[model samples]
Target: MFPKLDPILHSELRLAVMSILAGVESAEFSYIKKQTGATSGNLSVQIDKLSAAGYISVEKGFKGKVPCTTCKITPAGLAAFENYVNSLKEYLI
Candidate 1:
């Protein structure tokens, strides 16, 4: 039987966000939005979901007086991502 996938990471947008963060130490909201081609409102809502799940960390601050939000994957998140990938691989076997 295939392993169950994580519902939170199952989302395309959320998975994209996690994929981006998995490769980098951190990323700015604008960068994530640009990479994912997601609208601000949609991205914000998805981000809130990830944050609420403790899958990622969101930091709000300012860059030269302009509001800025950054995201980083937590340890649990990395493990979850790895497990998610492994589960996907199981489907192919």
Candidate 2:
């Protein structure tokens, strides 16, 4: 029997964040918040989790004196995102 797959990247917000990061090279916090329609607090928390997991890299800097945070999906994150898609296929079929 196939092993029970771990349920990771299942939350809607986190998934959204991952999906967005998957496509972009790197995006700023405001860009993600605008694209995902997620609140600042929620996005911040999720990004922190991904960063801690080594799935994403987070950078903080200034964009013309404005505070900016950028997020990029690491190779591990891409792999997990692919696995997440495969897991959903199990449910779909």
Evaluate all candidate structures by whole-model CA lDDT and list the values in order. Answer: 0.96, 0.87
lDDT of 1: 0.96
lDDT of 1 by residue, 1-93 (tens): 678899999999999999999999999999999999999999999999999989899999999999999999999899999999999999988
Task: Report how far residue 3 has shifted in candidate 1, in Å.
Answer: 1.2
Q: Residues 1-93, candidate 2, lDDT per residue (tens digit)? A: 443553448778888999999998999999999999998998899889888888899999998999999999999999988888887788777
Taking all chains together, each candidate's TM-score versus the true structure is 0.97, 0.91
The 10-residue segment with the lowest total lDDT in model 1: 1-10
Whose lDDT is greatest here? Answer: 1
- What lDDT is reached at residue 34 by model 2? 98
* TM-score, candidate number 2: 0.91
**Candidate 1 clashes between residue pairs 3 or more apart in a chain or in different chains:** none
lDDT (Cα, 0-100) at 64 in candidate 1: 100
Q: On a 0 to 100 scale, what is the lDDT of residue 54 in model 2?
A: 82
